[model samples]
Target: MFSSALSVLALASLCAGVLAQTYTIFFDNKCGRGTPTLVDQNGAVLSTGGAYNFNGSIIGASAFLQTGSCGPSGENCCTLKINDDGAGPECTKSVGTNNCPAEKCSASGGNLVIIFCD
Candidate 1:
């Protein structure tokens, strides 16, 4: 019985690891008028524009664009939310001039491009 319980625990651990998925998020800022800041689910700054590897459990990820110098002092900003969906990767802007619609992921993990305009 003791050995059987240990085997079950080991199998469960392996299954849990297999079920945990990781995604590579690419944030592209095409906004000509501002500097973008990427924020994760916990409001931690991820990156400006590049790549970030995130666990599948992240939620409420967003990106903000500062129209001035691209920092805390910048004014007139816009917020874009990153949606977690199995259908594809999606991004939606709450405010600002969006040049393109939300991008979709090509696979389970893909890039999300945010384009802003004046």
Candidate 2:
């Protein structure tokens, strides 16, 4: 019985590891315009939604999933890196100005919503 319980515990640990995946997002503030790109550790696009807009332009400015402003219709599930190229507004409003310091992780139906924010 002890051996059987140990085997079950081992299997549970293995399954738990397989269930969790870590993704990262980087915030670029060098450019006034904060461009968020999502990629996997292997750098892949999980969402058809484009680039997300981090609010520098307007308050109601939404965090789109892709290149333009999109609603929930926008949240492309990709790891993001911020390129701080001097442009539009000012990306630095907080510490996550260059990296996804604020990581948002959500688990749903074996899928995860990992959000990176500057």
Q: Per-model C-alpha lDDT, please? A: 0.58, 0.36
Taking the tens digit of each residue's C-alpha lDDT, what string does model 2 give over 1-118?
Answer: 9999999999999988775443322233332333444433243442332433332222112222343442232243222223322122212222322233354444343222434442
lDDT of 1 by residue, 1-118 (tens): 9999999999999998887666666645554544566777676788766676665544677766655544342223446667666434566656554433332233344445555442
Q: Which regions of candidate 1 fall more than 4 Å away from where they truly are?
A: 30-36, 65-75, 85-89, 96-118
Whole-model lDDT, model 1: 0.58
User: Could you tell me the C-alpha RMSD of candidate 1 in Å?
Assistant: 4.6
Poorest 10 consecutive residues by lDDT, candidate 1:
98-107
Over the full model, what C-alpha lDDT does candidate 2 score relative to the true structure? 0.36
